[model samples]
Target chain A: MRGVVLHAAGDVRVEERDDPRIELPTDAIIWVAAACVCGSDLWPYRGINEVTDPTPMGHEYVGVVEEVGADVRTVAPGDFVVGSFMASDGTCEICQAGYQSRCAHVEPVGRSGTQAEHARIPWADGTLVVTPGMPDADLIPSLLAASDVLGTGWFAAVAAQAGPGKTVAVVGDGAVGLLGILAARELGAERIIAMSRHEPRQALAREFGATDVVVERGDEGVERIKELTGGYGAHGVIEAVGTQEAMQQAIRSTRPGGHVGFVGVSHDVSLTGQELFYATVSLLGGPAPVRHYLPDLIDRIWSRKINPGKVFDLTLPLSDAAEGYAAMDERRAIKTLLTV
Target chain B: MRGVVLHAAGDVRVEERDDPRIELPTDAIIWVAAACVCGSDLWPYRGINEVTDPTPMGHEYVGVVEEVGADVRTVAPGDFVVGSFMASDGTCEICQAGYQSRCAHVEPVGRSGTQAEHARIPWADGTLVVTPGMPDADLIPSLLAASDVLGTGWFAAVAAQAGPGKTVAVVGDGAVGLLGILAARELGAERIIAMSRHEPRQALAREFGATDVVVERGDEGVERIKELTGGYGAHGVIEAVGTQEAMQQAIRSTRPGGHVGFVGVSHDVSLTGQELFYATVSLLGGPAPVRHYLPDLIDRIWSRKINPGKVFDLTLPLSDAAEGYAAMDERRAIKTLLTV
Candidate 1:
C-alpha cells in the first residue's frame, strides 16, 4: 500500500508502505475511497510542529469497510463510512455527553494514515458512521468533508450557540470557518459576518450566507464587527485560526455574555485573564467531536441540503498528495481532496 | 459622616467625611445598617493592590434608604435593601441578559464607599433590591452577605452548571467558596468537594453541604480531586481563588466537557491557550452578575432558608473599621462586619 509521509518540514511524499491490518478486536480495515488534507496537518508541514521522523499523515477519510474484526457490530464489510479523526468507544460517559473527542479511550486515526490504499480504524462501531448508500462520485468530497471539517464547523456553531436571533461571526476564512458560516446560517443565525481581507475567500464567505464582510483585521476588525452589530459585537464568534491574533479577535468580537466557539488549534496563544474575565463571555472549543455530528451531516449532505463539499477547491490523485499539501500551504486551495 | 479609608498601604482609618447626598437624579443616600470587609479589600490593605490617594473602600452592604433621588422608583426612602458592588442600569442589554456587571452603564459601588455612615448609591432603581419588610436585626449580616459573597457564590455555581448528578468542587475556602458549596447543594449537585487546608474553613465547608474535603494544594490538589471523582475530575469546579495556580488547578480538576466557574478576581494570572484547548472545558466567570441573583438570595435569607451570616466571624463598630481590616488581613477573621 502507498501512503503519505512527512519526513521533515515542507517535505510531503507519497511512498509505498506496508498495508495495515486489524491490530485489535475492535478494529476494522477500510479501503480508502477519499482522504483530505486538513488545516492542522499544515502545522507539521510548515515546521511549526516538529517531525523528528517520517510521520504518518492524514486523518480525515470517507471509505468502504473492506473487513471487520470479530468484535465489530454496527459496521460490516462493503459499507461506505465517514469517520472522524479521533476514534472513541462512543458509549463512554464523555462520548455520551456528545464530546467523543475526549473519550476515555480515544485514539487518533493519523497514527494509521488515511491517505493510503487502505486504513485500519480502531473502535470501529464508535468511530465510523455509515452513509445511507454508496454516494455518487460527485458527492464523495462532501462525504469526505463530513469526516472532519464540515462536522467540526457544525460543532463550532453549536458550541457558539449560533441559532435564531444570533449574529454569528467567523474569524478565519479557512475551510472550517467558511463551513461554520454555512452551519450558522443553517442553524438560523439572524446575521453572519465574515472577517476576511482576501477577495476569493470573501466571495465564498458571502455565498455561504455572510450578511456582511469586513476587510479589517485585529482591533480594527473587532471594531468593524461591533459597528455592524449595534456596538454589542456578534452573539456567536467562531475562531478557526489558532493564532493569538485570531483568538483575541474571536474573543473581542463577541458581546458580553455571548459565546465563542474556537476550534482553531491554539499555537502560542495566551488569553489575558483580566480581559476575558471582564468580557463575561463563555469560551468553549477544541478539537471537535466530529463523530457525534457525522450522521446528521451525512444525512444533510446526502439530501443535498448543504454544499459543504465545495470547500474542496482542488482534488488530486493519491500519488500527487504532495501538490495537495503545497496547494493548501500556499493558500492556493481552500481545501484539497486526495482521491484513492 | 465617617467612612473607612485606606490612606496608604496598611492604613485603615475611619475618618470623618461629609455626609453623602444625591449627586445625580438617579442616586440615593442610604444609612448603612451592615457593611463587611471583603476578601478583595485585603488586596489593597496588604498592598497586593496599590493604595493610591486614600482609597475609600467597601462595596458590600445592606442598608435602609435614608433618601431617594427624584428618579428613584423601584427603591425609595425607608426601604431596607440589598445591593451588589456593581451598579447597573437594568435597562441595558447586558443587564437584561443577566450579566449586569458588564452592563453598558455599569458603575462600581466601591466608588461611593458602602462602609460609610451615609453612602450614595448611584442608579438606585437598578442597583438595589428592597427586602420584603424591615428585616429582623439578626438577618442583617446574612442580607449583607447576599449583597456580594452569597450572590457571587451562587453565580459561580450556576456558571459551573452545578445541578443534579453533578460533582461540584470548590477551589477557594473563603466565605464565597463556603457559600459556593451551599449553592451547589441548593442547585441539586449530587456531591460537593471543598479544597481547604484550614481546619476551620473545612468545618464551615462541611456545614455548608460539602461532602468531601481535600487539603492538598496545586497539582496534588487537582490529583486528589480527580481521584475522588473516579478519575474523570469534577463535573463542575468553582474557582474562587484568583491566583494563576488556583486557576490552573480549577481547569485541571474539571472533567472534559465540564464547566469551570471562576469568580476570583485574577490579579496577574494568564491562562495558556493550549492547556485550556486540550482540556476541552467551558470557562465562564468574572465579577459575577450578583445583582441578577440578589433578589432570589435575599428571599432565601429573609426566610432563614440559609445561614450565610455565620461567615462573618468577627464584628466591630463602624468607627473600628481599622480593626476589621487588620483582622481580615491577618486571617484572624474569616470575614468582618462593620456595624454603623
Candidate 2:
C-alpha cells in the first residue's frame, strides 16, 4: 500500500508501506477513497513541531469498509463511512457528554495513517459513521471534510454559542475557519465576521456565509470587531488559529458574558489570569468532539445543504503527496484533497 | 466620618475621613450599618497587591439609605439595602445579560469606603437592592454577607454549572469558597467536596453542605478529587483563590467537559495555553457579577434559609478596625464583622 510519511521538515513523501489489518476485535480495515493534509500537519512539516523520526501522516479520510474484525457489528465490508480523527470508545462519561475527543480510551486514528491505500480503524462501531447509503462520487469530498474539518468547525460554532441574534466573529482564514462561518450561519447567527487578510480566503469566507470581512490581525482585528458590534464586541467569537496572537484576539473580540470557542491546536500560548478574569467571557476549547458530530455532518453533506468540499481548491494523486503539502504550506491552496 | 485605612502593608488605622455625599445624579449616600473584612483585603494588607496610598478598606456593606440624588429612583432615605461591591448602570447589554459587574458604566462602590459611617454608591437604582424591610439586628451580618461573599460564591457556583447529580468541588476555604459549597447545595449538587486543611474551616465546610473534605493542596488535592469521583474528577469546580496553584488545582480537578468557575481577585497567575487546551474544561471567572444574584441572596438571608454570616467567626466594634484586619491577616479569624 502507498502511504504518506513525513521524514523531516518540509519532507513529505508517498512511499510503499505494509498494509494495515485488524489488530483488535473492535477494528475494521477500510480502503481509503480520499485523504487530505490538515492545518495541524503543517506543525511538524514546517518544523514548528520537531520531527524526531519518519511518522505516518494524515488523519482525515472517507473510505469503504474492506474487512471487519469479529466484534465490529455496525460497519461491514462494502459500507461507506466517515470517521473522526480520534477514535473513541463512545461509552465513557466524557464521550456521552459529547467530548469524544477526550474519551477515556481515545486514540488518534492517524496512528495507521489514513492517507494510504488501506487503513485500520479501532473501536469501529464508535469511531465510524456510515452515510445514509453509498454517497455519490462528487459528494465524496464533502463527506471527507465531515471526517474532521466540518465537524471541528461546527463544534467551534456550538462552543461559541453562535445562534439567532448573535454576532459571531471568526479569527482564522483556514479551511476550518471558513467552514466555521458556514456553521455559524447555519446556527442562525445574526451576523458573521471573518477576519482575513488574503483576498482568496476572504472570498471563500464570504461565499461560505460571512456577512462581513475584516482585513486585519491582532489588536486591530479585535478593534474592528468591536467597532462593528457597537463597541461591545461580538457575542461569540471562533478561534481557529492556535497562536497566542489569535487566541488573544479571539478572547478580546468577544463581549463580556459572551463565549470564545477555540479549536486551534495550541502552540506556546500563555494567558494571563488577570486578563482572562477581567474579560469575563466564557471559554471552552480543545480538540473538538468531532466524533460526536460526524453523523449530523454526514447527513448535511448527503442532503447537499452544505458544500464544505469547496474548501478543497486543489487535488492530487496520492503519489504526488509532497506537492499537495507544498501547495497548502505556501498558501497556494486552501486545502488539497489527494485521491488514493 | 470614621473609616478603616491601610497606611502601609501591615499598618491599618481607624481614622477620621470626610463624610460621603452624592457625586453623581445616580448616586445615593448610605449610613453603613455593618462592614466586614474580606479575603481579598488581605491581598493589599499583606502586600501581595501593592498599597501605594492610605487606601480605604472595605467593599461589603449593609446599610440604611441616607440620601439620594435626583436620578436615584429605586432607593430612598430610610430604606435598608444591600449593595454589590461593583455598581452598574444595569441598563447596558452586559448588565441585561446578568453580568452587571462588567457593565459599560460599572463603578466600584468601595470608592467611598463602605467601612466608613457613610458611603456613596453610584448607580443607586441599579446597585442597591432594598431588603423586604428593615430586619432584626441578628440578620444584619447575613445581609452584609449577601452584599459580597455570598453573592460572589453564588455566582461562582452558577458559573461552574453546579446542579443535580453533578459532583461539585470547591478549591478554597475562605468565606467565598465556603459559601460556594452552600451555593452548590442550594443549586442541587448531589455531592460537594470542600478542599481545606484547617480543621475549623473544614468543620464549617461540612456544615455548609460539603459532603467530603480533602485536606490536600495542589496536585495531591486534585488527585484526591479524582479518586473520589471514580477517577473522572468533579463535574464542577469552584476556584476561589487566584494564585496559579489554586487555579491549576481547580482546572486539574475537573473532568473533561466540566466547568471551572473562578472568582478570586487574580494577582500574578498565568495559565499555559497547551495545558488549558488539553484540560478541556469550560472556564468563566472574574470579579463576580454579584448584583445579578443580590435579590435572591438577600431573600435567602432574610428568610434565614442560609446562614452565610456564620463565616464571620469574630466580631469587632468599628473603632477596632485595626484589630479586625490583624486578626484576619494572622488567620485568627475566618472573617471579622465590624459593627458601625
lDDT of 1 by residue, B1-340 (tens): 8899899888889998888888998998899998999999988888888877988889999888999888888987889988989999898778898988888888999997888887888888888999999999899989999989998999999999999999999999998999999999999999999999999999999998999999998999999998998888999999997989999999999999999999988889898789979999999989989999988888888789998998999999989989898887888889999999
DockQ of each: 0.81, 0.88
Model 2 C-alpha lDDT versus the unseen true structure: 0.93
**How does chain B score by TM in each prediction?**
0.99, 0.99
- Report the number of clashing residue pairs per model: 0, 0
The true-structure Cα RMSD of candidate 2 reads 0.9
TM for candidate 1 is: 0.99
- Docking model 2 quality class: high
Off by over 4 Å in 2: none
RMSD list, candidates in order: 1.0, 0.9
Q: Give the distance in Å from residue A53's predicted Cα in candidate 1 to where it truly belongs.
A: 0.2
